[model samples]
Target: MKRLPPLPALHTFLVTAQCCNFTRAAEQLHITQGAVSRQIAGLEDHLGYELFIRLARGLELTAEGREWLPKIQQVFDLIGDSVEQIGAKRETLQLKAPSCVMRWLLPRLMQWQRERPDAPVKLTASLQHGVDFQREQFDAAVIYGTAPHDLPAALHMFDEQLTPVCSPMLLKGAPGLNAPADLQQHLLLHPTHDDQDWALWLKAADLRLSNIGSGQHFETLDQAMSMASHGTGVAIGDWSLIGDDLNAGRLVTPFDLKVKTGLGYYVVAPDRPEPSAKLRELMVWLVEQAHTR
Candidate 1:
């Protein structure tokens, strides 16, 4: 902290130096000229140097001021860069999608961080997260919905399919679950996710249930998946989201049935211009990293 100046005073001094007139600088800064003068004076006293010489016409940069201008500009430039970096570090990578997508994306970010190291990835759970991407200061968005539809300049990163997931303990205990009717004996964990996921999975297997799904409903896929992980119940999980857990032996699908949803993960940027290198790197890495899943 000792290496830094009083921010307000430094701001005043910079503006005054730019205009070379306290009055104009005050107007630009919406402060009184006297305040500007006092700030510059305080800065000079702190440095044991005079930065300006007053004249009836206006103000002139002293020899010291002339020497300091470039250094001061460099300091201000450094400050600006530091602030941008901080903003980027904590920025919200708003995602307009289901909570399950958030769960999936965040865990995999470690791969990207291993490369960029400084990239900050934030996630939001909403279907409309990308609508105000610019105004909300979002660097990029990962949307979950049917694709081959119109998207922003961003790329379609990955395609997702559905697979059944259940707690290992539950599946072992429930037994007879090789077919859909046996599911009636157990709780069906659902968050009212994508339409027909359960129905399609059953349809593919030529099975139906009068009450195949009768259990407490969750509000988010993350919640449902968590319960499934704990052997609480069975759920229809998007492969893209639960694929890692399945591979890691944390969860498993006892059945081989699979079906594709109309939905997939899309990495959308604005329609206007090329996304910044940072956003581009983030977007590309996300797609490439998850495509195999």
Candidate 2:
């Protein structure tokens, strides 16, 4: 069997490789830059090869470092997975999802808990597109996108459709938006970096407006939906995220038209040799809920 470098040194090396700078890696790891440098040097000495090339500008990974980074990450992830499996006696299941999904799912999860009172759940709401299930403690995640690769198990929840929505207040004002073309006169709240939803929906509706991109920008779908709920402006909403809000009258679809983007919500579980039965039950419940709605 091949000997391995010290765990601390290997961790420091991985952080340094990720940030490509000792100072940034140290800051993230909550250690001093000098300590980071020392660990990297120790790791390189143990391995008998320089992992990083120190330049005046900053640290850059050597060819060997670049090749080893993913392998090291995988090792740490595997260690975390093993620890989680060993400590699986605890009944709580850690689940992660985007904030928008959390907003929609949290209220509904009461039913999940009620149905299976013995199976407790822990919800972690994050904006991250995908959770590193092996490295992170999340037993499963509800991710919004095309089917993510490398998961041991995945269930398609629902297809996503982009539809324009806003508070009822937007409909009462002068020059009110009665038609899709009238959207040109109001603000278009963007959920992400681009106005792809608005552009796609408009093209699908056959309404050409150059100024459709003009509007408020937010980093997450939840933020955009909130702004629209409060009558700030019209925003395109993901059907999977804003279905409850739409039904509750918090938001109203200004147009009946919807454009399917092919991307959808998926429940994903980590690639484990023996998958947890509890997580499988939760995944099944999620799919059932998606279908019933």
Candidate 3:
């Protein structure tokens, strides 16, 4: 077996390469600038090649150093990810979901906490619609898609029922939205840049508007729904996600029609022969809540 370079020197090199300055790297490592210089020198001598090109302002990586940075980064990332997975809290179930599901998921999570205080759940709301169990530490995730074929185990939460929603004030105002064709007079709010949600609903409704592509776009459905609640514009919202807003009269569906996009929200878990009892209980509870709500 070949002898490896010192771990400390490799770490120092990684930090220095990232910072591109010995002083900054030393400050981060809480070591003297001289020590940082010595470590880099030792590492270069061991490798028999210059890793950095000293510059007037700071430092620049040589061709060799640039190539080595990503490999060294991957090595540290693997070590960190492994340590985190092994040392993670076992009792608390880490759950991830997209921001759009917060309206529906948050209430149920609180209810779950109240009902079963012994089984704790930690939630992480992100813009991402999917999770990678191999790379992430989450125990399970709520993903929005047509199907959960990629997951080892998944439970259907609810189908995505899309319809136009807006504040009650908009309905009572002039340029009234009484029918699908009336949409031409009002501003449209889209959850995505492509306006796919609105397009899908429109296609289902068998209504074509000249300004289908024209609208204010948002990165997430949550943003578009929030704007709609404030009477900014008519936003295409998911029926399952906007139930609370509708009940509270914060937002209202102008038309009685709803279109199912074939896509749905599902609670997915990593590949495992047998999942924990708590995980199964939680997934079942989520499905129940979706049905009841």
Candidate 4:
């Protein structure tokens, strides 16, 4: 390792050089004038050079001291930059959720941010099918499944309830929906995923849909729900994911029956000795949101 003067001595040298007066430098540094003088003397001795000239009125920097000022100032600037970058990284948070749940959770998350003001959550809209949480740097994630693996802890947020929903306008127009069997008269939207939500609901109601495969198919439940809300067709949706639309009158469950799907939403977090304070607060808030829903 390279030998260098003590850090405190370097600080004192920089302060004394800037003021060119020991008494003023000590006052600025919140130290006794004698202590400032000692530190400067020690630094000069370590460097094997005379750094100042004692004058009748005050003091003046020598040739070497003037040349060293800029270099020392650069060092302080670098240190300050490094500290700020580290602080910013610590404050940031990363989170992941499926696209469908993201739409429903985002508004509630905004409310949480407004209430807390200090804790912020960064959301990543992702599907769980191909994700590897263990390889990623997410602070937490929301997953839909019966059980999630490779997590320190998984908190079940809510179970999915599948119900047939469509725009009120659809009910007012041609082939209006009145019962599960009446669904054959109108278009049926299907999600690309093989959740078989429609088939499950049909089985619960003791009914069958032979043309279920013919209707327009969407990549996500969000897309199918969007089509349903526009009166295009009927789509099976989880009540948890469409609560806002239900309350806002954009979509309505025509039937009273709700089929309980085995899958559920869970908050998955890494295992550790103790959870972060922010993460703990978020988990609690998520549970509350699910309960109220």
Q: Please name the candidate that would achieve the greatest lDDT relative to the true structure.
A: 3
Please write out the lDDT profile of model 2 over residues 36-143, one tens digit for every residue: 776677568668899989999998889999999999999999977965775475588888987657656886787887788667777777767678865787788889
> Residues 1-293, candidate 4, lDDT per residue (tens digit)?
54576565688888888889999999998767876776677578768897898899988888998889999989988867965665376475577887668657888887987896567777777755323556888888888777776665778889888888999999899886887899988888875556377888889999987777777766667667766887989998888778888898989999999988888888877775356888888987897898886
lDDT of 1 at 257: 68
Decoy 3 TM-score against native: 0.67
Model 4's number of clashes is: 1
**Residue runs of model 2 more than 4 Å from their true location after superposition:** 1-90
Using all chains and alpha carbons, the TM-scores for the candidates as numbered come to 0.62, 0.66, 0.67, 0.67
Order by lDDT, highest first: 3, 2, 4, 1
Which residue ranges in model 3 land beyond 4 Å of their true spot? 1-90
C-alpha lDDT values of all predictions: 0.69, 0.80, 0.86, 0.79
Task: Quote the lDDT for 245 in model 4.
Answer: 87
Candidate 4 versus the native: TM-score? 0.67
**Per-residue C-alpha lDDT of model 1 across residues 103-153, encoded as one tens digit per residue:** 677667756656765665555556353445557655567776666345456
Per-residue error (Å), model 4, residue 78: 30
lDDT of 1: 0.69
lDDT of 3 by residue, 1-293 (tens): 64477566799999999999999999998767876886788678778999999999999999999999999999999977964774364488889998779878898998998898677888888878888888898889999887878786999999999999999999999889999999988899987768788888898889998876778876567667766876878999999898888888989999988998888999999976466899889999999989986
